[model samples]
Target chain A: MALNQTLSVQRLDDPAPDSPIIEISHLQKVFAQRKKAPLEAVTDFSLDVRRGEVLGLIGPSGCGKTTILRMVAGLDSPSSGSIVVDGKEVTGPGPERAMVFQDFALLPWQSALENVVFGMAATKLSREERVARARAELARVGLSGFEDHLPKALSGGMKQRVGLARALAVNPTVLLLDEPFGALDAQTKTLLQDDMSATLQEEGCTTLLVTHDMSEAVYLCDRIVVLTNRPARISQAFSIDIPRPRGERFRSTPEFTELVDQVWQELKAHVTLSNSQAVVEG
Target chain B: MSSSIRTAWVAFATFLLLLAGWWGVAAIAPSSYLPTPLAIFERLVYFVVEGGLLDDLVSTMINIAAGFFIAAALGIASGLIMGVSRLGRDTIGFFVDVFQSAPSAALVPIIVVILGFGREAMITIVVIFCYFIIAVSTAAGARSIESGLHDMSATFGASRWLFFRKVLVPGSMPMIIVGLRLAMARAFNGGILAELLISIRGFGGKMMYFGGAFDFASLYALIAVALVLTFASMAVISLVGRQLIRWT
Candidate 1:
């Protein structure tokens, strides 16, 4: 249950940072197959992620949350509609949006330090500058001592931390996290969520996190976006008002419980709808 | 040290057993078909002292080196291209199947006649023999690259050239090295066969010559040297592969 804590809002008079770092409009994505059924993964999904705001997307598995994120990240193209990031339509992958993949996706041949360095190299940073920046980013992710270790040698959490450091090193305007902490143990996940939230706040970067964990979304995000199952659409969005530096105690509040129930109820209805649709289609 | 000592003792016992078996067979048969172990050992020492085998061995080494280099260069380049592009993959894939399945050894006499027996002819044969193996391995290696790494590079704005140089090359290195090892073994066998039929300046030719002259001891000694060379090549490849895997 998410707390009913009135989601905090930026001062109305204060200008929003640079006008929607990511603006996705009516995006539709369909995965077509030959001699089989066609899959509509996302349908007319739209959202505006403003600068310096953490937007969490929570849905059941295969509800097209990942498809939305991938389209926004420019890893996949939308079948219809435009994705304008920083006012430019995205047709392919660009450095402006850096993604932290679910699996850490680090190059196996590279060490943690080298992975960070490679990410920073996109901006044409000098070799020394790249190294220094990589060290600083690794330290930021609490990986100061494991810089020289390969990804295979690290635990899943540590590897994801390396993935985080790699994305942060790029200094992108928007960060796309596709269930970045899904693979970690509960303790590690909680700790990493705190670390990631703190880092996103400090960096003042726009973020889109796709996750199945409702609590995680409620904890870290300024707003939560819910998507309906296959051929998913924006079912609803909720604002989370917990203050900065939100800690464990926040999860226990009456407000949090109210909001969590509200979102879960909506999600259950969507799931039922998905099942009926599946049965009919089958 | 203990393990090495144990290994040495085992090796010594094995050698003694082999020698005794050979001598026993020779004493009972008194056959011209087989030479005594002692006679072969003495002949080997004499050949080394007289440098009779050195020239032949050097010639074979040169041919193998030249052939292996050419095969490696062509194979790796073509393999990388085929692996990276769908069109290249489709085109070269068919050629690889043909070359891999065709009678490689059967082409030896034809190549010898066409090229006119010389160093070039031997090298051509060895190169043709090893190329398909190396190319197919390298191509398969490139194709087997993890999609995550490819996406990672693309997300980082890696240009095609940079991606190939930094990502694809390192990722495929281990498999490519394995391909090289396979090619080296093939080249060795091809080199020996080429020497036997077309040239008089390699160990293979010397072996044939000794056999014809009734110098069975020298022929056996040459066979032993060839075995040692093959083993040495395998050892070198393994050592190099271990170092490469560690560094990567």
Candidate 2:
């Protein structure tokens, strides 16, 4: 990164002060499909995301972490309760939030430049300003000179970079990621994780991530919250004590491994109980 | 070599083989009924230069083009509506299914009585045959876009127009083009039928005139021109479609 020398670490190895930018209270979601049993995804969930802190949501496969993330993005509604961003009650989608999807959700018809420009499409900014900002953001994400390439022509990593550029281009007050690197291969995910660490450090936006990987949560989040499967609740929350500017060396640190193991231990017991119960029912 | 060039060469080879086969068939059949390749070629040139038949061809094309554009506009609109709205799909979807398969020729006699024998009637007939196919294609195309994509757009606060223009139109394009190809092919077929049966005018009428006079060579020439136009349009469309959906 060209800005690496200028980049301040902005490390919060200590717990952040209670300056909550995003507040969720008694949030719940229930899916009612016709001709099928109702599925309760989340129940009695509440959390406050501190300003400039990366908060991670990790849970079992169907724990509704994505549902909670979507609700915060204002794409889904809570069956009951409220989500407030910057003290304004979020009813529907607003430009103050940007989401990075797991599937790379890039519109196939548009080129990377156009896709990145999509972020500012809802804004009142002049077209020239939008175009300039889009170019700058794509370049910031290391996607310079590949502006006109369509998502289909890009590799998985390149496509995700476009997604990242699209998200960060608008300069949203909140950053929401639903397994942003989940679809990438191990090598690519690792590389992206490092890049994301740098980007998140630089942007310093309030970040919320939903992931299945414990170590990934530990690596990226200042605080990681684990949820229970089906009718999800905050089972536990861990404050990651690992130092920032996370590099390859961070993965092997004792604190990092110990934290991951602790999360695994809790999640493992839950999974085993659920599996044995399913076997008995079957 | 590039795939497009390889395809062009293969197409050329196919045409050559078809011509050779036609010549062989003409040699086997009686001279009065089936004209030789050289005979058709000569008659084609004569019509182009002396008979003023290009005007008739142009007239037929104008009707086809009119019907095509109208159908494309309406079909895309209806398709997008159907794809997005469940109520719209439920209400009009049945009509789309029934009319798309209805023998296009049957509609001509009924339409002819109402609109009278003219270009308007023929254009209407062509549109009736074409629009349903295009609509069905686009609707299916629109439905195929994943829900995650829509969620992403909504999360980013995409306006309704932006969603339709950037998301729906482009997402459904691959199938929409396929539908266009099918609809255009039907347009030519419908145009020929309407012209042949309606008032004995345009390229279709010229074909009929040659046949009634027992001029096999000229009839073959007209058919050959029609065939060439059909293939040419399809080739151009496929090339454009390839360019549009390169990402997939």
Candidate 3:
């Protein structure tokens, strides 16, 4: 944890270290169903993500963490409130933000390289430049020879690699990940986590990661925010004291386990409470 | 044996079995309505060589081609419109649903009455038979495009035109191809039905002439030729469709 102390001192030295790259304020979302009552998914959720930092949102499944990420991505408009990225207020999806989905939403009809190139469609780059960038991004994600493979041909982890490459190809200021590794097997998830940690360090892009995995949150995020069950609100926030560029060996370390355990304890209480309340209400 | 070789062997065996079965039935049956395989083969040779069957086959194919292409253009355009817009879906999609469910073959008589007993009437019946089915399938394909892909397009700030061109159109292509294949079969049926009902022309006319003269072997031969042609055309469509959606 000595690295945490050094980073805090360094943060004090910087002119505006506290300034946020993404500010989400009073975000609310209610899904209106045709024959059922409107379901409130998020209420008054607020957070500020510092530049070049990984911020993780962890909660029970279906707790509106994904809704918040979607709202930030501008794929779903908030019922009320605002999201400001960099300096501009986000009215809809803009060039500055890109989202990596849980399902690795590569177009089934497109090759891996083409899927990456698609992310840059809104950019001012020429066709040659776009193709060049797409190839480079695919190479960066260790998919050099697999560029022509469709999504169905690729493994789950490989598909996510394409998803990550696509998001990064756009050169976004903020990256939104919605449970990116939730679908992968355990071994693949660990391997991806290691690669992701290294990649995030290299890219140094501000990222908002929504995941229910406590260990993943502790490993990848600088800060973790836990939310209550449906109509999610911030229940707890924890800062991981570990240094960056965490490796596979870090997963066995005492600090890593300690942070994960702490997040789990906070998260477990909420999950239990929500489960009991649901039983009673039903 | 290799899979392809095994498949070829099975197909060859099946053809032989079918021919033997048909021969057995023709030997037992009293009426000339069931012709022997050898008789039908001889008649097919005569028609192809000297009886002007080739000219009638070419003309019928032209009608089917023209009608299918026209149906495809109208179907795809309207289907895409219905897919993307609520107004389009409610208005045009409603009518498509109604017409698609109705017996399209029954409408051939009405079309013949309106356009009269001509090539125009035949083409009209073919178009009517095909248009609704293609439109219905295309709309379904467009509507069923993955919602995640839409989100991906939006997140990257893609323009409406760009999304339509790159994502919506390509995503709906598999369904469009499905629609086209089905429409091709319907076009053939319509072309034949129109020839039978409106006027004695094309292969349908040849069949009527053979049946009247009690040339049962020639009728069976013409029917076999038409079946072979239909199968060949369908295979061509499937090949083109496979090429279009190679990713799937």
Candidate 4:
């Protein structure tokens, strides 16, 4: 254990090229809800996200999928374990990794264009360049004409697109999406999923998405990592060997159903285990 | 433009009707206290045409402006501190309670005695009176920011400075504007109160002077001017706040 800790620390400290984009080992998160006993949100989680790979984390509700994603994104800290992204240990948030939140956390005061430009401002980009780049990104996200519209005025899908544009504007090496399209209508979710898959493919940036939707995971992910409920640990990792440019037909194929069933089986056991724990605790 | 003109016409009509009613009541009663619209208007015109009403008005305006700006600067700074930090919240919370409950009239004698009867005393009184409202409201606004937004920004890899610059400022603006509007009304009242008690050169001072000499017409005219200033300031605050709401 000491040797692993030393290796993890060394791996994090060095900014070498060959290191995985994200490495997490024996990660745990405990939340203390004032006066109540601490709840173990996540536990003994371990995973590696290779550069340019799209990794999906799938689990039932309360399975700590979002917690894992947040920890990877450096939004929250692990109780124990090391998280190294791009060969650097993430102690706090840095611009190297950008996130698209579940609720589409766009600045309501800023227009879509302004929101995108805001993300780019922390970098060395000039104001004019930021504007131009922001415009291009908005156009890429199919928001060319609605540049001046505020987040409140935009539809859920549109708002999510703006969130995506804002994250992409930073030109980060890793993109962390916490159910970026979870709140949208089914049609909107499908459209956004396609856009997201295409965007990641085009950018070739490492992605780690947390989702409950099995189809979304199979469609977009290079590998889907299933987790056991509460004190979550990786139960299985399934590599999707499907060809790219997946359409509606791909979603209905036998291959897709088999993968979904496989994930669902792992998920069912975890759900049962969590329910029994709740009953016992109660 | 046309709709605004209609609004102006409606407002003017309402004012004329109110003035007519006041005149009719005064004429019917012929009391020693109340003055007619014509009498008040004559005094107002006389002051505008030949007297030092402008100078008196400007002096009072200057006092209010100076005191208001000073209070605003200090109040906003203190409010931001109180709003942003735990220590500031605890320390300022006690002062806010004391100031909010303290009577404006009660402080006039103390302020005049300490600072002496002059523009400095008047301005000082106004600043003290207005600071608490602005600061308290601003602190409330700052404290009301959603913790989730902070978490999201942090996770997105935004720095502490960036989070403050981007989220905190924009988030607090609505509340700050509310504070500003509330503070403006208090500031105006403080200015007038200070002049009534401590200064010899403002509209409020003029009102007291005319009232003491049994010059009811001029006193009423000065009162009207004060009302106009208060309403106009309120209007400006409302317009600015509306614009901010629209932007968000």
Binned by DockQ into CAPRI classes (incorrect, acceptable, medium, high), candidate 3 is medium
Ranking by lDDT: 3, 2, 1, 4
Interface RMSD of each: 1.9, 1.2, 1.0, 2.3
Please provide, for model 4 over A88-182, each residue's C-alpha lDDT reduced to its tens digit, 9 standing for 90 to 100. 99898788888888888777888999888877745787989989999998999999999999998999999999989988988989998899889
The candidates, ranked best first by TM-score, are 3, 2, 1, 4
lDDT of each: 0.84, 0.86, 0.87, 0.81
lDDT of 4 at A193: 88
Clashing pairs in 1: A1-A260, A2-A256, A2-A260, A3-A255, A3-A256, A4-A255, A4-A256, A7-A240, A7-A241, A8-A241
User: Across residues A1-282, which tens digit of lDDT does each residue of candidate 2 receive?
Assistant: 322322223232333477799989899999999998888999999888999889899888777899999999998889999999989998988888999999999988789999988877788889899889889988988889999998878889999999999999888899999999999999999889989988998999999999999988888888788777767888777776555658767888776677688778767865666567567857
Which parts of model 3 have CA positions greater than 4 angstroms off?
A: A1-17, A276-282, B1-15
| Model 1: per-residue Cα lDDT at residue B184 | 86
Candidate 1, superposed: residue stretches over 4 Å from native: A1-18, A252-258, A269-282, B1-31, B34-36, B214-216
The top-ranked prediction according to lDDT is: 3
TM-score of chain A of each: 0.90, 0.91, 0.92, 0.90
Alpha-carbon deviation at B205 in model 1, angstroms: 0.7
In Å, residue A100's CA in model 2 sits off its true spot by 0.9
TM-score winner between 1 and 4, please give it: 1
> Chain A TM-score of model 1 versus the true structure?
0.90
lDDT of 4 at A175: 94
Q: Fraction of true contacts kept, per model? A: 0.51, 0.80, 0.76, 0.42
Q: In angstroms, give how far residue B232 of model 2 lies from its true place.
A: 1.3
